[model samples]
Target: MRGHPVTAMHPDHYESPAGLYLHIPFCVAKCGYCAFTSYPCGNAPPPDYLVALRQQAERLARHPMVREQRFATLFVGGGTPTVYGGAELGGLIRECLTLFNFDPEPEVTVEANPNSVELAKLAALREAGVNRLSIGVQSFSDRLLRGIDRSHSRAEALAAVAAARSAGFANLNLDLIYGLPEQSLADWRETIAVALAQNPEHLALYGLSVEEGTPFHRRSEQGGLALPDEETVQEMEDFAYGQLATAGLPRYEISNFARAGRSSRHNENYWHNGNYLGLGAAAVSCLGHLRFRQVPEPERFVRLINDGAPPFIEMEALPPAAAFRETVIMALRMLEGIAVAELAARFGVTPQDYYGKTFVRLQAQGLLAVEDGFLRLTARALPVANQVLAELV
Candidate 1:
């Protein structure tokens, strides 16, 4: 059931975010595999996008969640957060943290492209309270990188990390992708080695999926691509998982891993159903019970917020049952699975009551088990998570 059209939630009913997320929707160029609403080399965005972001943050600050609680996690991800540069970007970020009441030691994170990470901009952000950086080092091999149309060279990524370290930014993260066309299991190994060599506090490794409307998706549809076979893809994933775990960054989620205390607390807020407000174009927010979408056009966002109103494109507040379903799907992404007692505590029903049949069926296949009253997926389930999550859906 849809509730009121409120953008902010009362913290007493909703789970307060240990973290916050701001969607920086500008990219220098969109990757072949990316379907997010990012335009590279397209239009010169107005300086007012930053103002609108601050408006969104300040608007939500009036809510009980922002007024009463402090954020433990803060992630500003994008098309490319670094595209905006240092002073301009830093000022906007500072405005947001103050509005949201984020903790001083919050895990502040921003997504960066290897091409975007320079010494000057990197240092500016560190001074502005950005403690973590997530750079897109999608592939180290120039051949594969060109195949994906990533903007950075392997050397640039390496140099960026060095620059970050020299700038006194120790909590660096590298994001990589596997399962590209013509990439061997050995190729995955080399990429992993290069990333681990950096000794980043966090790592995010994603399996390649050809999302609809993306350049990669179009290429696959036209038979212009040749993805690795499923067996080899599985083998690649398995090898990377084991490799990262051994390299001091263990797997924390199906597609992400980190060293101790670096498991992306901002994302963990999402996994645990923590409420967060998304700012900027195409940014999404789930606060209180209302889930809302913002306008995707940069110009439109500027115009709307300038009009003294948040330009929410869509919104939905969940009923208790729907919220329960959402919580199940989100929490299930963790290897820890869903906590049975916790689910019952929140929803007033056991896991067996809401999703008993699916759980029992998956358990019979040795893909799931209930241990200590928590439902968890086995390692085997991870490899076929799409299929497993489908059962729950």
Candidate 2:
């Protein structure tokens, strides 16, 4: 099946977003291990890019689907949103709230790098109605941080948290990465200890994956990288889960842990197959049944929008079977899993019927089980979830 064209968008065709995502593709410096669609902009973001962002926002607001829907959450993510300066970023956010209908108490989040955030910036974002902050503190170990080319030092990471607290931002998330070159178990433990001491409401712990085109990938291919062995990495993951749970932030997803009521609503929307509209360069939007991504280059995106053309570089209308497969894959990432009856109702086929022998075989191997009307991975399967999801897909 093919997705409908962008021209086919209508009020009735809208699958209302649970949230909105605005991507700021500019950063002061790109990290060696980063593969996201972000570029370096020294000192501050280009003024022209901000103007283009506004244009994109205006154009999106004019869409029938956007005009008719009220978003429940908003996430400003980036190369580093704080790089745009708090006042400028605040104005852009204010414009969005004015242009769209949002829930009275929407969960507004912005991603910040420890090196970029300051007390003044935090205050501006708070004044702009941002209630949540996801700060990238990658590691508290200065040595490990320098190895990964992180701009922030240990002191900066700690100070960022203090500043956020001082600015009256109570709901905070800290992002950490493990399995980096020269990152030992002790190093990870200390990082976790420092992060927990900050008392963030949420945490996202990710294992390092050296993506192609990243500097880390080249280092690995040439045998210059010294990443921990798989066993050590697994130990680190286990330690993190245990520590965070003890800290009262239980694991809510494979890579995320949160205190009660603090889970990321925007990300949960994605996990549950809820629709969202993304704006700005390199943003991806899934509206109705179509998935599309805007042009990645900032200049190209701005130029195309100025030309009155859709900036999308790729799009796909998901087939029913493909959609069902995706729904299962995403939902299974959560600890609660997916309801069997609900899946059957939506897709017109039960897991047993759709997956046939693969489903049954996984169950027999103790990797999957049907319990409490939901299909879920067993504890043993969580570590090898990729292999299990591969079979289903």
Candidate 3:
């Protein structure tokens, strides 16, 4: 297999520890707006699902490339990992630790939903070496949650946060969504206020998008989904940026905010365009210049693993120039952005040499700026970041 050209130039950078991601595809119920690959399995994954996952892990753990590099982070995310019983989830974590080579101070995280998680589950995860807990508290309003077809209520969300705190997790992240149907600026303010009251170390804010094939998409096509106006949604974003900054959880990435030293290491690895190994159905992996994803269906993925077939159904081998552009685009999501000098050092290609006329045009439009050696989006360009990024890529 051909490696990234930069790997020869900077061997240490390519050989450094990679992040690990495990997908839990089981959920209690599918939300109306969700497009993630998930099966509504009532609560936990089937027994055979875990067996297939273990086989995949063992296979990867024995690979020469995987064994050579230590892992610095492990993120367990899914339809709802907390749906599994406390003891069961704890055992899974333990098995992963024994099967992989991890950094001495790895940051292990698991995503949970409010209705599926309790104090006992939280405590068990903490004991199993999960230092970070991210709870999907999409909204604090019961009405908004119901409108989106979330299984959890406002009370359950609040209790989940309190329970995580009591379980010895000091590092916590809350996920929130803005611009729901019939939601107002005042409603968004209340949601942010309630989230702040919990004193979480990190916050992830997302705007609701009507994706294809979702119920929301169908409603939008039929003119039935009463989504907030674009202007009101923009207002909500502005308010959240200022409010969270004042609360000392400033925006570190476009959608992620963190207190000092609390940024997610696993996610940061991605923003840096670093290597990562992903296991389970629909999970994606990036190593060197190769990117691939497992089969989207859980049942199919399990069968493939058991049948001794490679689970990846799609793969891409990016050329050096494409990979360079990808790295820059991903890094630009960070608030501090990518260091122009660092890129030149690692890739031996300066932004001026690579981007050329496009770079000059964006900088002239005041949409992109180089400040203190970093190429970052200016405040004026933040709201239109998607457009700006498309131009770069």
RMSD per prediction, one decimal? 3.9, 3.8, 2.9
Query: What TM-score does candidate 1 get on C-alpha atoms?
Result: 0.92
TM per candidate comes to: 0.92, 0.95, 0.96
Better of 1 and 2 by lDDT: 2
User: What tens-digit string does per-residue lDDT give for candidate 2 at 205-320?
Assistant: 99999999999999999999999999999999999999999989999888999999999999998987878899989899887678889999999988988898899999998776
Give the per-residue lDDT digits (tens) of candidate 1, residues 1-393: 222222222334445545677777777767788988877753344467777787777877786655776677778887888888689888878877777777667888888887887899999999888989988898889999988988779999999999899878888888898899779888888998888888999888888889988888889989998889999988888888888888888887777788887787888878878677777788887766678898998889889988887688998977766677667677878888777777765666665666656666778998877888887778778777778876765
**Largest TM-score belongs to which candidate?**
3
For model 3, which pairs clash?
none
User: How does model 1 fare in lDDT?
Assistant: 0.79
lDDT (CA) for every model shown? 0.79, 0.88, 0.88
lDDT of 3 by residue, 72-102 (tens): 9999999898888888778878788889999
User: Going through the candidates in order, what is the number of backbone clashes in each?
Assistant: 3, 1, 0
Worst 10 residues of 3 by lDDT: 1-10
Candidate 2 clash pair list: 3-317
Model 1 bad stretches (over 4 Å): 1-18, 42-45, 63-65
Q: List candidate 2 stretches off by more than 4 Å.
A: 1-17
